[model samples]
Target: MNDMLQVARREIKTGFRNPWAYSFLILFCVFSLCLLVINSQSIVQGYSGVTGSMLSLILYLLPLMTLFLGSFSLTAEKEEGSWQLLSTYPIGSLSFIVGKYIGLSIVLLTIVAFGYGLMGVISGLVGMSFDSTTYVLFIAFSCGLVLLFLTLALLIGSLSKNRWQALTVSVSIWFFAVIGWQTILISVLNFLPYTWIKPTLVALTFINPAELVRLFVVIKLGGGSILGPEYYQWVDWIQRSSGSWLFIAVCMLWISFSIMVVYWLWERGRSHG
Candidate 1:
């Protein structure tokens, strides 16, 4: 436990120093302000066009920022021989990795909070009409993305031999996860039997953390009908109070499953090394 905390503490310091982390911080703050300017003319209430637009813009920025920031942090441990130094100690791989996850989560969430908090304050001062519920939802959506995708980052960093490889794969994943989500799903699901498509789509949605969280937020914001007939039941259930807790449980399962896989992989590599 102490070792995990130590690693977490170290990670918090390193994450703040990472140039890539700062680069994203600057970009997010600027983008949030840009969002503020672009939607200034409209009332950004609930899940209106303005708030939807804001959500879309944030979706693009946050995931990639997290992936890069997190993957780089893990890879740095390898490149700098920090892992080698740690091997001399009795620390378990799980402790070290979980520590990194905890630490980096703080750093990334801090960035999210600051970006949105600044935007909220500025919006209020300027008399923008966005409500507080929208901010709460946005913050929840952003935090979920961070916690879930950081698991992928740990996996990517563990798989990668160096930073360049990590960078390449991370961007590729970001593109697929965020940009190409619908196209790829539609293309692949097209080949399946008509009856299979819905089930497959549902399964695939759960498989992708970005899509999962995005869908949850969309449904919460009263956009579930737009998801088409396939998700009618699922969306309806999720909109209910009990369904909200179920969604949270699924996210917990996602993180737990990913972390288990990461630990197994780390243990395998350690044994071989």
Candidate 2:
């Protein structure tokens, strides 16, 4: 535990010292602030309008930020032979991985909070009304999504031989999750029988963290009115079956599974070489 904290602290310090970290911070703040300012004037439905807009934006940006941040975190160290030096020490690989994950998660969470909190402050100054419960839920969902992507990034980093390889994989994943996932799902649906479409879509949603987060946020915010009638039925079924809890469980499983893969790969490589 103590070793993990030390590793986490070092990772946190390294992240804050990096120039790109600040760039990410600035990008998130600027985008979030701009969105808040633009919507402040037309916030008709209290927090729903703003929250919905912010969720859409986050669904696009957060994955990109996390993928790059996570992909670079360990790969750069490996390229510099830092891990070799650390291996000479008493720290176990599991501790190192867990520590790095915790540290990066804290850094990402801080950036996310700053971006969202800045918007909240700006919205308050402009007298935009928002429901506290909905606002909190949005923040929670966003944070959970960030952590999810960070774990994935770390897994990719652990499996890659160099920073460039890690980065390439990271960007490809971001593209698939943020942009290509829906198109792929649509194509798959076109080939499936009508009876299997809904269940398949629901199963697909569980497979993609992005979709899981979107479903949770939409259901919690009561934004189903904007969805098509077929989706509404799907959402209703999900809600009735406590799908939100299941989603949360799946996210937890993803994180654990990712960490285990990282550990297994790292150990295998070390044993073979």
Local distance difference test, each candidate:
0.88, 0.82
Candidate 1, pairs of clashing residues: none
lDDT value for model 2: 0.82
Q: State which candidate has the highest TM-score.
A: 1
Best-matching candidate per lDDT = 1
Clashing pairs in 2: none
Q: How well does candidate 2 match the true structure in TM-score terms?
A: 0.89
List model 1 lDDT by residue over 1-273, tens digit each.
999999999999988887877888899899978988976887666667777777788889888988888888878878999888998899999998899889999999998888888898999898887766766888899999999999999989999889999999999999999999999998999899999998899899988999999888888888887889988988888888898799999999999899888889888888888
Model 2 misplaced stretches (Cα beyond 4 Å): 44-51, 225-234, 237-246
TM-score of each: 0.97, 0.89
lDDT digits (tens) for residues 40-136 of candidate 2: 6664343366667777788888888998898899898789999888888888888989999999998999998998899898888878765577667
